[model samples]
Target: MNARDPQLPLQPDEASQIGAFAQAMWDEHIVPELTHYIAIPAKSPMFDADWEKNGHIDTVLRRAAQWVEQQKVAGLTLEVIRAPGRTPVIFFEIPATKAGSTDTVLLYGHLDKQPEFSGWRSDLGPWTPKYEDGKLYGRGGADDGYAVYAALTAILALDRQGIPRPRCVGLIETCEESGSFDLPLYIEQLGKRLGNVSLVVCLDSGAGDYDRLWLTTSLRGNVTGTLKVEVLTEGIHSGDNSGVAPSSFRIMRQLLDRLEDAKSGHLLPTDFHCEIPPERVVQAQTTADILGEEVYKRMPWACGGDGGPVLPVTTDPLQVLLNRTWRPTLSVTGVDGMPSISNAGNVLRPFTAFKLSLRLPPLVDGNEAALKLKALLEDNAPYNARVSFVPDGRAGAYGATGWNTPDIAPWLSGALESASQTHFGTPVGYIGQGGTIPLMGMLQKGFPKAQMMVCGVLGPKSNAHGPNEFLHVPYGKRLTAAVAQVIAAHP
Candidate 1:
């Protein structure tokens, strides 16, 4: 982890000659540029109203493309591609050196980050990049920003070594945080300009605690909605309706109890169905062995004493991974139509509503899940009370990454193992990602023949999209070099 250590990797000779040079450039220039990249709060869609006015997305593209341009990559053309009303697309191309070897590899990344939420140990801020204790504290630093830098550094390193760099293309979007609504438009408008792509590298995902190159097999789909009930025309004083009127609160309780069993968090319906891939189970077992207790500590919260059946907290790692990536889960996100305790009215509210969010298994049919959930709530609601369930936004899950492509498995595995040795204390291990990246699926549709490789610097306890997000800097620098090495060796 020491920055001064020269014994790190790719011994002075076997080391990527070009990568060594790019390493100097990355440390002096790219790393500093990322500090500015992290400082901009260009939250996509969540803070879209501010985004257009702030024009922060444009600032990010400028910095990213400018950094790429400074590399002095030969035959590489960098351009800011934009269509009417859409975010800027940063494109860079390196033409083919040989006739049959002119295959294009597309690199993908996003500039917009998630909204920075409050509450942290005062050390982590989304807009502030600080290198402390060997980690880089900032937003979008690891989740993907590094991927952008790494991809460019990778191709340029090969170009510097006098190696025949593959025909390359780059795509950096500003709205990936908002499910990439403008992505289809960008691809459609520049479909031909993207050139003949043979491979893709998504630098948005994460690694295991030991720095394993994580390959996601699948991401769970999600559907969220609200369930409401009305028991009376108006609120009556609780003191006055003590024994006479049926409280809406009581009815809502009954309806929800029928929907979710408090004793067990499992959903009662058979609406969700997905057979887990055997490779995933084996991978989970490998993760359990690699992460061990740190996996348990990294979850949201856990019960300290390991209490009774109706325990207040839970912390099981293998089960946790299973619950997150493969199984279906539902949670009551928020409650509506309820007054604050400070209001202190003796009145019993006449209506109540609760927000419901569900994470579904792959291929579970989003519309089917929606209809099944609607029927479950409507049929289970208390009679004589007006009850309704309405579904809001729903996003389908992506399939597991395709690993059968030629050269991908060997190229990635070698880079990861080398990086782990040079960075962490042990070898690499694989794990599945819980969140969905829609671009992964969309790219598959546009170029079915291209190979996809996903890797990043986030690991266990390196929270993203939550309070106090950070990227491991020393590890990231090494990982960037690892990516450069991979691209250098790619056939």
Candidate 2:
């Protein structure tokens, strides 16, 4: 009878406090803030070598810190600590009472955005945050910029209710779009200071679509390399070499073709085998039923290309999720060595290269995968033309044994469920997000004892990182309340 209840059911006033706070803030306060934020193209130095000189990065950090400081959450203070050459990380903390009574939750997010790639519809650029059809569209909005607001919105909402809270620390990273190159150093620098975190909530990624809130159980490791095909020592005029030049680009495609099955989009090499675990298979099936045809339709594809529904995003949500979270998959992210249109010439380029990004499953030894991939690509090169691989980057994938999950999941599930009943229509569905957040791996290593929750407002069609990327304004506003409900009911 003396045991504390597993959940602290919210009083009506408490529930109102949560919802009203988010709704009010988002409608008037949050959107404007995100609008101004999305306008700053603070590309990561990892992606833009001259980011500092561009000055947009500094502007972004300052604006984010300023917006956070304005939140008036009692006892909450924001700090920006930066090592000499490294990017800045924003830290904010609402100190808790009775030190050990409520656990400390370390909240993480990022402020940087990806470079704007081509293919944006006119007026739908990365810097333009547009509102249309129940969504906020912009580059940084979903990928991570929204997390800054989402984290603070949740933290502030709980405080507005006067509920005693876990010591929530907001860890805002700057290089997330670029593989978190500076995270380890930040973690090391913050060393003992980041000690005693009880739970980690990474607000970077989100559910597959918009029906549910997802938990990331694992992230696929990544190996990025450039495959270069050198067909000849010198360029030859297309008129003279039309038949004999042997296009380097053509050769590159042929090599790539051998790596994957053209029909089903499956990787052919046995070197990248990963089976969807049975439990996850069940998760996928459940998700498939919930998602139905909408899942495939949500994907952005070329015009007249499967414009209608095709196969369920993955017949297995778990398998689909696994391919994203755990398995190794080859994606040719970029191609180079071809001349541009403005300088069009009828000459065969001497060389061509394709940038490849390979996702590695859990326990697939990152180094081993890199080596295996290098060998595979080299061997697959067609016509014995000179070929070489340029190592871009490599990192290990991460998987946390959800051991403490069983203990903490009830609180998370219930909190979100309660909020969903009020805001979303149903209980928050548990799902997985595919994408590499290296800091999650570092945090998992740094705080093995801390149970983590990774939730956010980014949806599938949000098109983060690509052109026309945007955040769903009202949805994010409501998510703040959802986070608050969970925190208030944390047992």
Candidate 3:
């Protein structure tokens, strides 16, 4: 086989070969690497404060780098770049096989894992690897320790078949699960070394289903922080302080009322919301039609008193999709100054604190929202309590802004369509993800003309950041081939 012209689309036989190559690569190498990667608890910097001392992040980074180097792709140069007090990044570059091509395809993923959430099945654990029924069950494997492996495999598959491709670069970071706080610094340092980035392949977003290729069009911004309300200097007997001193929990609830409507679950502040673009609305409607009841039913709802599944906020598929993707929502992820039921006592706690995670619309400014959120929760405290809302991250980088993808170019759109049809036998699906990817927004600002192919294997019930998280191995194999096809078709 000879290297084909970069201008021509991949033929059916060529696509088949690419698919087979990807499958073989996954079976022979990638899956085993991910299995070992899953066993290491390389939690993100925020989750593991002692990441520098613990060295788990470095272990994963070094392993991935070693694996990439072992591949020995022609004209490849790899580096594990690091700075003081920051997580490391694996930066690798492959010169273009196509003559006179200057554009770069920046492939992005992360090796960091989320904290160990509860509720895994008996046989599955966050750090315990299990492969069952074509699903790699464990933390980080799907959300997305397999990204670097899949990315390199795609490149190798193309090279193996003598297919010409443009310059490709990989930026696999170790701080994404912590909102990618360290990425901006590295991106700035890499500046011109990143080349004229024309396409970004971010394999960190989600898929609505495992049937076909799904493109993420928009992502919600996030503002996380701790909101604490101190009503008393010290704990007191509940019997003595019931009427005299106000309960910190009660004051905390009152303060939260300023931000959210408890009954409707709506964010009371209008600044956090943004108008849903018409195109995105149309895409959401299409996705809703395809997904139907599964849009809401996919949630692991608890059983109701009547022995039926608990109802979601809404059953209308379009509304459910929009509510999650284009609306502002608040989640109190953790609480402090509360004792377990087994350790409960008749003493009023001195303070009440909550770890707040606020998701804003794609167009909203996360830092601005964070500032407003701080003022809203801390002002006019109930019973003159000492209340504060401290936003997460450093002073200037308190929140993570969301991303709205630019209009897809004709060549890229056709490539995506052809790749999806070739791999999954369906046209590409477009959907907006409710989760935030901080790097997407940063890249958009850095490379305004770049086409964002933000897709991933996080399909229905893959439960990332929660218990029993697994990577759909079959979907992953197809996705890898599909990615190679798209890259081959890149103009």
lDDT of 2 by residue, 302-421 (tens): 565457434443654445555665555677888788767988798889999888877766545555666777777787467789888765543442221111122345656666677777
What would the per-residue lDDT of candidate 1 be over residues 1-491, giving only the tens digit for each residue?
Answer: 11222223345453546446556766787678788888888778545666666888888888888888887766778888887766677877877543355567788888888877767667667887886776667888777777778787777665555444457788888877655667777788887887877667777777666354454555666666788888778888889875676767777777766656667766566666577777678778778777766665665564355552323224666777777677776787678888878975888788889877677775566556777777777874565778888775333321121122223456556766665554444675667666656677667667786666666777766788777777776566666666655554445
Give the residue spans of candidate 2 off by over 4 A: 1-8, 98-102, 209-212, 239-246, 302-326, 340-345, 362-368, 378-386, 394-408
Better of 1 and 2 by TM-score: 2
- Give residue 65's lDDT in candidate 3 (0 to 100): 97
Rank the models by lDDT, top first.
3, 2, 1
TM-scores for the candidates:
0.80, 0.87, 0.99
Find the 10 residues in a row with the least total lDDT in model 1.
Answer: 397-406
* Candidate achieving higher TM-score, 1 or 3: 3
Give the winner by lDDT: 2 or 3.
Answer: 3
Write candidate 3's Cα lDDT for 105-202 as tens digits: 99999999999999999989999999999999999999999999999989998998888888999999998888888889999999999999999999
Q: How does model 3 score by TM-score? A: 0.99
C-alpha lDDT of residue 22 in model 3: 91
Model 2: weakest 10-residue lDDT segment is: 397-406
The residue ranges of model 3 lying beyond 4 angstroms of the native Cα positions read 1-3
